[model samples]
Target: MMFWLAFMLLLSAAQRGDAQWDWLTGIFGGGTTGSSTGQNDPNCGVAAGSRIIGGQYASQGMFPWQVSLQNLAQGGSHGCGGSLFNNEWVITAGHCVDGMTNPAMWRVRMGLASLQYYENGEQEFTVTKVIMHPSYTASAMGFPRNDVALMKLNRPATVSNYVNNICLPDRDASVGTNCVVSGWGVYDIQSQYFGQAPLSATLKWTYAPILDPGYCSQNYIWGSEMVSSIMVCAGYDHGQDDACNGDSGGPFICPSPDGSRWELNGIVSWGEQPCGAQYKPSAYTRVTAFKSWIQQTIQSN
Candidate 1:
């Protein structure tokens, strides 16, 4: 509607929702989900190609950019994974629709693979509107900063087969660059503890250089400067990697046109703590620094 209130803000990037598009919004982390020590807790997710390890890289198409969304108007209740930029926009991360001003709560669930259980094609829409970033603010919780958001689908979104859309990153793309962030997130593997379902996670990969934001904020070189013009960072730090709970608003894609080509750079915002367990790096929200507020909020709705 209002372009899904500037991209369904949900920076915990962990928030998620979907009750069969009952409209409105709003995980599993520790214990029970598999057991064995929570199934070897690498964050949990063993086999279906592990879940949330963050460094996210192993790759080969990883479910062609998973997307389930399904009726949400309550802050990512359990909905996250967007990147389709056509037929009504869907490039998430404005904290997954910042606290709904209320457009009847919100609803959108397109083509699923696994948000719980859906196999034979998925599609559920009704988010009359949602378009955030009048200066997005996590407003609370560890204060991740400006984070990002986008959603607008009272209609439009009926791709086919494996659901589509995933490419953006070339507003001259390059700021200490390195991109590629796949979703349907969470990963650990081998030892065990894998949760979430939806295959093709052939162990998605890519965590290179990942820096931007005046040097990736030197990573809190004090904690502030790295606001990095709105966020866009990644990591390596000598250990496993991360990005779990449901890979929220997916797409940190980057490679640059002249750099080799691979647009859509930034959307999977929220990180610096979980996922990719090391040197703390996983921030995204610099889609070319908002590209004129996403073409002035998707060409004025």
Candidate 2:
């Protein structure tokens, strides 16, 4: 049933689902005063941002093989984005787990560049599955096709100096370089909670450019069910910044083609609503055009 109507439209677009408008966009139609203004505000709808200057134990400049995939990543918590093909693997956003497909409900918590969530923090693990990436379709959530996902972790994390991993998108990782899109998300788009607020951004590569298939299906507002070889787009057509919703999966890196270091060419999928809305750009999910379905789904697990 199309992944169970995308898992009941992803639990009626769970913004921590408790009630409010969102019976699949019926526009604030539930109760509890729009569900406590979407639970004390700041989820301004549609994928969103904030995470600049390398993190997660960021390095790679003076030695230690130039690290940083956010040292493994840390934000509001319970997974959204972090680790880029290393630390035994983590990467995220299969719709954050889309209807919780159970991988031990994912734990992963790495070094902490922000978002504490209680003392003695940082370094938590427990997943073991949740691959997603069979080529997500149904015209994806606005260029969300194959939104990307991983996880795996059931024992393999102990690289010090603050965790590691960050490199994956070198099948000629191209598209006008100069990237760097970390996460922990949130840059005050009206402060509804402002993402993780650990913040990170570099947004350039032509200030978010990639789409062109008839201009992403004649531009926005549901652009004719966008689909051009499986969707891809970038941001800043003169406004709106992104990586919203706790920064989905994370990583929009660059600098590879043998120039060495910094790869991960895309993962923070879906956009075109708020978190950088202005001619609506911001869309991803083209990790080297689906690197062979992410190495045959992580080598058939």
Candidate that scores best on TM-score: 2
Query: Taking the candidates one at a time, how many backbone clashes does each contain?
Result: 89, 27
Tens-place lDDT digits, model 2, residues 7-53: 10000110122121111121122111121111111111111112223
Instruction: Assess every candidate by TM-score.
Output: 0.30, 0.31
Candidate 2: stretches off by over 4 Å: 1-69, 72-89, 92-107, 110-114, 119-123, 126-151, 156-183, 189-228, 232-266, 269-277, 286-295, 299-301
Residue 138's lDDT within candidate 1 is 58
Q: Each prediction's Cα lDDT score?
A: 0.47, 0.44
Badly placed stretches (over 4 Å) of model 1 are 1-87, 92-121, 124-182, 189-230, 233-241, 244-266, 269-277, 295-297
User: Could you tell me how far off, in angstroms, the CA of residue 177 lies in candidate 1 after the best superposition?
Assistant: 24
**Superposition error at 168 for model 2 (Å):** 20
lDDT of 1 by residue, 59-138 (tens): 22233334445334345444556765554566677665566535467555544544455445456666666777777775
So what's the TM-score on candidate 1?
0.30
